[model samples]
Target: MTDSWLPTLLTETSEEGYALAVRLSRTAVKLTQPSAEVRERVRADYAEDFGALIAISHVVATNFHTVAAANGFWRS
Candidate 1:
């Protein structure tokens, strides 16, 4: 995980954060596409990448909530 997006995610509006999270999720999927070598190296490398990708998904969901709240779209 790079520090690059951390500040933007923290400071930008929820909409921006949601966009960024979606982009990150796509990128992470591309990275983890299973090649033979990649499968062999999962313990050494791909596991962390996969974990981070899951974390990004969580962030995306959180941002969705934020956007909904900002727009007064929340349910009781």
Candidate 2:
């Protein structure tokens, strides 16, 4: 991932915010693992693990919290 990724976290809608959160989560994993082959090797382990799924959900939620705050909680 050589693209420049700077999160403004200033989304206009809650749906967009959620999508950003998911992207944030995926990006983190990509950066940490860095190797597609390694990530694919362990994919099944996390894919079938309930705890791992919940952990990822928590990460996305945490990222969303920041995104929401930056957007003023999407207030009108």
Candidate 3:
């Protein structure tokens, strides 16, 4: 895993930024909303973040592959 992506996640500072940063944040909130209800919310948040990260990573990796393929520098 690349450590470089760490800062990109940590640097987000807005509502949109929080949406991105929460994917990588170490913070967790304890719910006042009751166990069953809060459990669903937490699970959904995790699912959403995981999907977003996977999609973003896929796009980035695909772009890198395309660039490398075009350059022919990765041919071996």
Whole-model Cα lDDT per candidate? 0.57, 0.89, 0.46
Name the regions of candidate 3 deviating beyond 4 angstroms.
1-48
Arranged by lDDT, best first: 2, 1, 3
List where candidate 2 sits over 4 angstroms from the true fold: 1-3
In terms of lDDT, the poorest run of 10 residues in model 1 is 5-14
Clashes of 2: 0
TM-score of each: 0.35, 0.89, 0.34
TM-score computed on alpha carbons, candidate 3: 0.34
Report clash pairs, candidate 1: none
Evaluated with lDDT, which candidate comes out highest?
Answer: 2
Candidate 1 lDDT tens digits, 1-76: 7666334334245456566557655545556774656546654564568786687668667666655565455232
lDDT of 3 at 71: 39
The best candidate by TM-score is 2
Model 3, span 1-76: residue lDDT tens: 6665334322222443434434433222223344676666666665768787787566555544444444353343
Ranking by TM-score: 2, 1, 3
